[model samples]
Target: MSCHVLYGIAGSIAAYKAPEIVRQLKKSGYSVTCILTKSAEKFVSRFTLENVSEEKCYTDKEFWREQNIHIHLTRKSDILLMAPVTANTVSKCAHGIADNLLLNCFLSFKGPVIMAPAMHAEMFENVAIQDNISLLKDRGVYIAGPIEGELLSQDLGVGRMIEPETLVECLSVARFPALSLKNKKILISSGGTTESLDPVRVITNKSTGQLGKALSNMAHLYSADVTMISAGDVSSIGFKYQIEKTASGMHDALHHSIKSHDVLVMTAAISDFIPEYSEKKIRRKDNALSVSFKASSDILKSLSEQKKERVFIGCCLADEDTLIETAIQKCKEKNCDYIIANTASNFGNSKRDFTVVSKEKELDSYSGVSVQEMAYRILSLV
Candidate 1:
C-alpha cells in the first residue's frame, strides 16, 4: 500500500492553490487526507479538497462532531504537510495552540512535518514569525519554502508559497527522518564536465544534473553539511558550491573539498576523453578535420588512494550486459565503499533503475524509483 499523507491548509491568499497540492500528492501515488482551517475555507471549499484528494476533508466542524479525530488522523498518517501555512498557523503550531482541528493535528502528529509558509512579505519577515520558524526548525520540522515571488497584493517578495508541484516534491523527499546526518559533512559533485577543443567548441554529455540536485536537497533535508561542485547552474540550490566546467577543474575542487567531508558522492559525468586544446576556433575548410583525444584522469581512483576514514560512493554507467559486473569491478578498483550502477538511458530521467554494489557483493537494486527516494536509500547505507 502507498503511504498516507495528512495535508493541512491554513488561511492565506494562497489557499486557492491547496486543491492542486492535494491533486499532486494523489498523482504521486500518495493517499491524501486534507484538513482546512476556517479561515482557509474563505478561499477554498472543503468540497473542492475532497473532490481532488478523493477522501473526506476534515474541518473544525468535524473536530467537535468526531471523538479523538486528531489522534486517529495522526495515527493513520505517514506524513503531515502544511502547504500555504500562514504566519498565524506557524505561530500557533510553534506555540502549541490547538483550538482548530489543523492545529490539533499538528500538535498530535509525531511523524515528519513539512510546512510551506505563504503570506505578505512583511508578515513573513517579522521577527516574531522568524523566531517561530526557527523554533519549529530546531524541533525537527522541515520547512519547505517561502520563496520569493508574487504575493496577494501583487507585490513581489519572499512570502509566496512554492508551487504545488515543488511542494509535493519536497514532501516526497522530506518523508525521511529529520537529522539523519546530524554531525556528518558530505561533498558532492554534479553535472557533466565540459572539455574544450577550441575557444567555442567543447565536448559534453547529456547529464542534466537533476539527480545530483535531488541528492543535494536530500542531504540538506537530513541536516548534513553539504558542499557541491557543479558544472551547471545550481542557483536554485541554497548551498555552498563552486563551479567547475572541466574535468581537471572538478578533480581539483573535489580534492580541495573532500578533506573536511565524511562522505563523497561523485555524480558528475566527467568527460572520458579530452581533445588537444585549440586557442582559436577551428576553421571549417575542405580538408577533413581530425582531432586527437586523451583519456581524462580517474578522479575517484586517485581520491580513494588517499581515503582514510571517509566513505566514497561512486556512480557508473554501463551496458545492461555488464552493468552489475562493471559496478562490482569499479567498487573494488576505485576502493569505493559503494557503487551505484545504471545505464545511459537514466542519464536525464527523473525515475531511474539502479543497482548498488559494494566491494564484497551486490547490496540492493531498485527499478523506476524517484531520484529523491534513491538518494534516501543511498544515504541509508552510509
Candidate 2:
C-alpha cells in the first residue's frame, strides 16, 4: 500500500521536532507533506521541512487556492496528522473556524485525521479544551496523547507532546489485524431501545451497551467489517468502541438494519413493552397515571427465523432467580450458537456473574470478571 501522510504543525515547544517526525514518516515508507501554521514557523523553519519532505511547505490559504494545492494535497494523502497541536488550533478545528491554510485543509480533507495535542497540564485539563476534544470525537477525529513529562517552563506534569518515534510506532501498530475475517461482514446491535410513550418521552431499559461495544471493537480488531447499529445516548467503555452513529434520527435500529452481516451479535437489552397509544405531549398528571402496555417487536426472533448461514449470539438477563435454565431456554428458543445470560439488577453496574449456554453442554459458571473480560470470553466461543 502506498501511504501518504500530511503533517500539520501547531505552536508548541515540541514544534522543533517536526523535522524528525517527517524523517520518521519517510523511514516508515510514507510520502510526507508538511503544513505549518504561523506560530509553528517560529520553532521549525519551512526550509528544513521542504528539504526533509522534498515537497512545498504551505502556510498560506491564498497560496492553496492560488495553485489548488490543498485539494490536490488532501487527495494525495491517505492520512492527515496534527502533531504538537496547540490548544488554539484544536479549538479552531473543533469549531470549524479555519482561518489559516492548515486549518482549512483539516476542514476540507476527507481522509483519516489523527491529532496529538501538546500543552501545559493545566491548559490540557481545562474544561473548554476537554469539550473541544469531545467535539472532535463526536465528529470522528482520532487523537493521540499529550503525554506526561517536564514542561517548557521547567514544571512537571502531563501535556508534553509524544515523541516522533512514539507517534510512528502508534501509527504502525495496526489498530485492526490483517484480514482475520477477510470476507466476513458483521452486524452488531447495541444500546437500549426506547419504547415511545409520547413524542418527547419514552420507556427505555438500563442497558449501557458496554458488552456490545466491546464485541464490535474486538471484531474490528480481528479485521472484520463491522457495523454497530443503535449506539446513540450510550457511552462506550473502551478504544474499541468506535462505530459510526446511525441511530440518531430513528428508533428501532435493529429491525431496520438487521439484514446485512455474516455474524450477528444481539447484546442490546431491548425494552420488552411499550405504550399502545403514545401522546404527542407529556401526559398531564394530578395524582396517579397509567398507560396501556404491549409487547414491542422481537428483533432477535425475526433474525433467527430468517437466518441463512449467519452466526447469531443472543443475550438473556435474569434478576435474582433462574439464571442457567432461562439462558439455556433462550438459546433453544432463539436458535443461537450461544446465550449470555446474567443478572439484570447488577449487570453493567458491577462485575457480573454469567454462564455460557450452548446446545451440547452448559458451561461452568464464571463470576467476578469485568464486562470487558466477559465480552472477550464470549468472542472466544466464536
Candidate 3:
C-alpha cells in the first residue's frame, strides 16, 4: 500500500511552493492530503493544492465544522510534513498551541514528523525561533532545510525553503530500508580538519560536514548505534558525538573509538599536509612568507590496518574524470571495503553525484541524489 502523507502548510511567502511540493510527492507515489493554516491561505489557494494532490484540503473552518477530523486524519496518515513552516507556526508547535487545524493535527499525529522552515533571515535566526527548532529536533522531528538562497524580500541569506523535488526525495528515501542496521555499531567522522599555521591563523578545506551529518542521521534512523567525530558544530546532531577540530585530534578520537564499532565510515576531510605552527601570531610583511609543510597522519589507512573484523568505508574527492579510478585505488591502498567517490565541485551540496566502489569493482552509482538516499545506499551494502 502507498504511504499517506498529511501535508501541512503554514503562513509564509514560501507557501506558494506548496502545490509543487504536493505534485512532487504524488509523483513519487505518495498519497498526499493538505491542510492550510488561516494565514497560509493568504499566500496559497486551496483549489490549487487540491488539483495537484488530488486529495481533500482542510482549513480552520473545517476544524470547527467537522467532528474528530484531526483525529481521523492522524489515524490514516503515515507521516506529517510541514513545508514552508514559518517562525509563528514553529513557535506554536513548540509551545503545544493548537489554535489552527494544522497545529491540532500535528499535536495528534503519531508517526514520523518532518518540517521545512521558511522565512526571512532575521526571523529565522531569532533566538526564540532557534530555541523552538531545537525543541522540535529533540522530540525527533526531522527538520529539512531553511538553506541559504534568495528570499521573497529580494535578499540572499539562509531562510529560503529547499526545492520541492529535493524535499520529496529526502522524505521518500527516509521511509524505506527501515531499521536495516538495527543493533549494529557504526562510527562516522565528518567536517574539514584544520592545520594551524600560527596562533591566530589556520588552513581548512570547504567541507561543511553536511554529507557526514546526513550519514549520521540516516544511520541513527536505521537504528544503528552511531558515534560521530566532527570538526564542526555538534549542537544540531541528536546522537552521541565528540568534537575534534584538528587532524591529530580526529586521529586520536577515531583510533580510540573504532575498536568497539563494527563499521567505520571516514567522511572527514583530514588535511594531507600540516604547516609548522608558530607560538606567536605571524605579523604581516610586504615580502611573501614561506612556511614548511609536513605530511599529516593517514587516519583511514591506519585505521584500516587495525580493522580486524570491522568494515571500513572511505571517501575520495577528485575531479570527475578520475573520481572512480581514484576511489578504486584508495579502496585497495587504504584496505577499505567500500569507497564513496564524488567530485570536488559537489562539496556541501544538498544533492550530489556519487559512485560507490569496492575493492573488486564498482558497486553502484547515482546522479543528483539527496544525501539521505546516498547514505541509505551505502548502508544497504553493509
lDDT values, one for every candidate: 0.86, 0.72, 0.85
* CA shift of 292, model 2, Å: 0.2
Residue runs of model 3 more than 4 Å from their true location after superposition: 1-78, 81-175
Rank all candidate structures by their TM-score, best first, as comma-separated numbers.
Answer: 1, 3, 2
Candidate 1, 160-195: lDDT as tens digits: 887888678777665565446756788889999999
Quote model 1's TM-score: 0.79
Number of the top candidate by TM-score?
Answer: 1
RMSD of candidates 1 onward, in order? 4.0, 15.7, 9.1
Q: Estimate each model's TM-score.
A: 0.79, 0.51, 0.63
lDDT (Cα, tens digit) per residue for candidate 3, span 1-382: 6899999999888899899999889887899999999999999999999988888999999999999899999999998999989998899999999888899999999888888899898998899999998788667677776777788757997788877876775575447535457678999999999888998999999998877777776776455788999999853223578999999999999999998899999889999999999999998788778889999999999888788888898999888888888899999999999999988877878788999999888888899987777777777767
Kindly provide the TM-score of model 2 when superposed on the true structure, using C-alpha atoms: 0.51
User: What TM-score would you give candidate 3 relative to the actual structure?
Assistant: 0.63
Q: Write the per-residue lDDT of candidate 2 for residues 98-169, one digit (tens) a residue.
A: 778888789879876778889999999999999998788556566666666779779997788777875764
The number of the candidate with the highest lDDT is: 1
Candidates sorted on lDDT, descending = 1, 3, 2
